[model samples]
Target chain A: MSPRDLAIKDLKTHDLTMREAARASSGARVDLLLIAEMVRPGSRVLDIGSGDGELLELLATTRGCDARGIELSREGVNAGVARGLAVIQGDADIDLADYPDNAFDYVILSQTIQATRRPKWVLEQMLRVGSRAIVSFPNFGFWRMRLDLLVNGKMPSTENLPYRWHDTPNIHFCTIRDFVDLVDEVGAGIERAVALDASGHPVRFNLPWAVWNLLGEQAVFLLSRKG
Target chain B: MSDSDTTSGEIRAFEPARGEADHPHSAVLRFGADMPLQLDAGGVLTPFQIAYQTYGTLNAARSNAILICHALSGDQHVANVHPVTGKPGWWETLVGPGKPIDTDRYFVIGTNVVGGCMGSTGPSSLNPATGAPYGLDLPILTIRDMVRAQAMLVDHLGIERLLAVVGGSMGGMQVLQWAASYPERVFAAFPIATAARHSAQNIAFHEVGRQAIMADPEWRAGRYLADASSPRRGLAVARMAAHITYMSDSSLHRKFGRRLQDREGRTFSFDADFQVESYLRYQGEAFVDRFDANSYLYMTRAMDYFDLAADYGGVLANAFKATKTRFCLVSFTSDWLFTTADSRNIVHALNAAGAPVSFAEIESDKGHDAFLLDEPEFFAITRGFIDAAARAVGVN
Candidate 1:
């Protein structure tokens, strides 16, 4: 059989529209945009777990930033390459630290900090290899999540916290405050911060700490070398 | 179905029937059905055929040729109609006209590795001597064996030297091997998102996948091929397990995250309630239908055994000693599987060996699967490298 036929068949059988697949999480691209904005034009950017190179392409097109991505899925990589993006198939846990120090202007780790085994170590490596970094993760301390856990007595499973107890890849779930404390402990200086609400709107128009954990549900941070 | 040689000895007949059916113009070519593959323990494989595919026209000089090697589960169909799944080639992004590899400018060749079941000689091929599939009787193969088989095919086409050789993952392993074993034969090498040796953790992952495939009840002691029953569930499970290792933890969070699949409420059962679970299940299910289970075992084993430095007196540079083949080693920042450190290791070795090499660790969020994506940085790098190499070799 021809590959075109197979792709068509697979598309028909397993075709989930972008909105359906992304679901309510489509707003996360806002976080991606925030990360891109952190980078200056001509700065080299590395998005460790780039999905389809969307953010990297955005950076390149919008800011003329040079971006490189590493993805693990053949289909995702193929999609990125189809869009004329450059992506390599690989795993981040085993591959990220191999990069030399100060190789990039900004190393963005958006929304994936919770799933890593060694987020602190990964962060340290990112700081070591790049002049600046962008780290974002869902705020497990959101009132809804805390209320869900307090009221229901189980691991919260909502739009942002959808995984069940057994199968969830969120190995290191943390709240906005917890991550802030982590950045301090690691001695990485915070340059700027933004926390978006569930509706994808910005929270804490002025002071970040006041509305970070209390009002805004999701947390996004920009960090740099402390010294 | 046959053509006769005229006085000029160049009698061309009707447009040769090409593709799937048993014909001369088929992309896949089968051989060694008569000989049994002798295993390490003296076990024997009766017969087998290897599947392969070719793209672009072979020029009169045949020197303007490039060979593409596929990763695990990839078949000979690099940029053509896949026979089983009937898909439109896997690397169409890099191999089409006007693309980086540029099929219009280079006669591209791709083929199934020795242990693959697509069309190349593999455990699934029939043993002509016994009229039975080779099964476990096929000799265990290493990266060198695959390269050797490919070398034979290149010779058959009357090509002296290749303009360039490219691949990623396991395919990159083959590219490295080609440069090491036949330095005089390749002009340029692109080994993306791959490593010189499998890490201990990666070996553990492969072991887990192998165990998964072997544990399936349908495996039936490797005789499942004859019974028309494959260890599909096991293979699916194995694929699902391995698929997780292919992405950055960041990618999973960005993609499935803690999100639920379909319904708003979690059913709270062991069923696929989360989007991640459903996604994994889909990956596994789709994989089994298009791939042969035995081929998985062989391919994974081949990946596990790839140790280029070990073969060259414990010095990775020794493998590339005195070779003029220009090398471009690319790594993604997020690809933990073969890390940028891995590429640096290759670069260091090439530097030590005095080989002309360039290394780039393109920043990307897509994790390890960055080379196949649409990163302009990667495209520019590839286009630059290929253009430079083409000029170096006087190809275009």
Candidate 2:
């Protein structure tokens, strides 16, 4: 069976137990757990670029949220739908605008921002449609990426950023500092932000922004419209 | 048939011919002179009967029953062998022992609509007062009436609530009507390739078909049964036009595309020189053999008059405000008749009412008939939606 089919089958067989394990596993991806933590129980959520709906199922079962998702690829949507997630095949850039204002309690764009054609507009629409928005993406200014560019003289690829530069879907690559600046420029308030290391754990709880930007391999931010 | 006969197993009734019977697959629900159906068009239909078929076995909780609403030209032979066509049921692809509907898990019911000719209390049925076919004298039906009749049947079956109500096209309208009319009874709803109200262009097409049927000389003012004649020609033309609407332009072009008929070249006459013409002609000819003319008119009229929002003071969300039913709307990308926008509109209303709803726009060039076709995306979405709803309703 394909990886997607296996993932769906795994979900169908395991249900809540597997999800609980994934949430509690220290080896689990920190971004997914952090996003799940930020969302309140019984809230309405829309997950953009909801790949195979792993997070969607987590939210619905663990958090008791009314979860819906919009996945870009047919395969991802099929996998999600087969696992009984309310995932529709849609483009995040074009379909996000169709949602009504304040339609969801939380709108999540997880590790998919850099792939979007219009990342800024997508964030703005997410804020407009949801009371709060959560976004997570791989940081391009990690120390290893800088060293690779400085020593190897080529674009960097890490465990999180697995694709080669030419074939990568990360169109608008952004560092932790760059995303923070962009969020400020867009007039949104950052409610919480976490910079994670390669092992999927926070780099430093009380570090300076520049220090965290240099060492953090990935970042997650909770944002809301500025008053 | 005994009362126990109607409750379990297959019970055939009213089978006069192999394919020409009123009710073929199961027992008929006969209403005496005391219990008359009060129609919206201000007429009383009495001494009537409703023909229905069932699949799977009802669970002890009686909570695993699903009501499958048939479209304009559909009948109660869902998930089984169709008596008239001598073929598998119309939805056999998605609804069977192991298919998406999973007849092995749920007790499925499909009833002939009130205005349908398939053994239901339609224009073709006999009127006790006149001792003849009701024909034009039959009260104009609506989607709500059909749903009400289904509710009566559900009551008779001792099912307090349905796990889900599912349908496509005109059948979808009944699903929506069930949600709106009896919010508590319908636990979940799947309305595919349908809109809250018929589009103006759709009404125009129905009007043209009605005019065709009415213009036939053999119609005899819908008294053709008494004269031992039928309006075959007019019904054929009507079906031909409606068939065109069911298919997409791209599909027709791909299937026919000015291809020659049987002969190599045109016969220099108005004959069916092109393959598309011949195909449509065959469709029309085949349709007239099974359908009744007056029933066609009534069914189309019922579809045209369906406006759920109008019944709820012009706000679609109001109709669903009290509804606890979970909804899933499906539409084809290339279906101009009931486009994705229509499903989106319904989704928005459901959202406004704080109802749980999902919408899927399956990519297909099969047009409105995509619901009836073998679209994998549609099947997956349906399976997912139904399974989730089943879990919610405690259907093991």
Worst 10 residues of 2 chain A by lDDT: A1-10
Model 2 chain B poorest 10 in a row by lDDT: B9-18
Q: Give lDDT for model 2.
A: 0.82
Clashing pairs in 2: none
DockQ for all candidate structures vs. native: 0.02, 0.29
Candidate 2's TM-score: 0.89
What value does the lDDT take at residue B85 in candidate 2? 62
Q: What are the TM values for chain B, all candidates?
A: 0.89, 0.95
Q: What C-alpha lDDT values do all the predictions have? A: 0.73, 0.82
Shift in Å, residue A168, candidate 2: 4.4
- Report the lDDT tens digits of candidate 1 across residue range A1-227: 22233334323322232233255354437667656666788887878777767887788877797676666664555555444444555566766765667867898887788878899898898898788989888888888888988999998888866889889988998887888889988998876666678875556244446445766678777789888
Model 1 / residue A68 / CA error / Å: 23
Q: Which DockQ-derived CAPRI band holds candidate 1?
A: incorrect
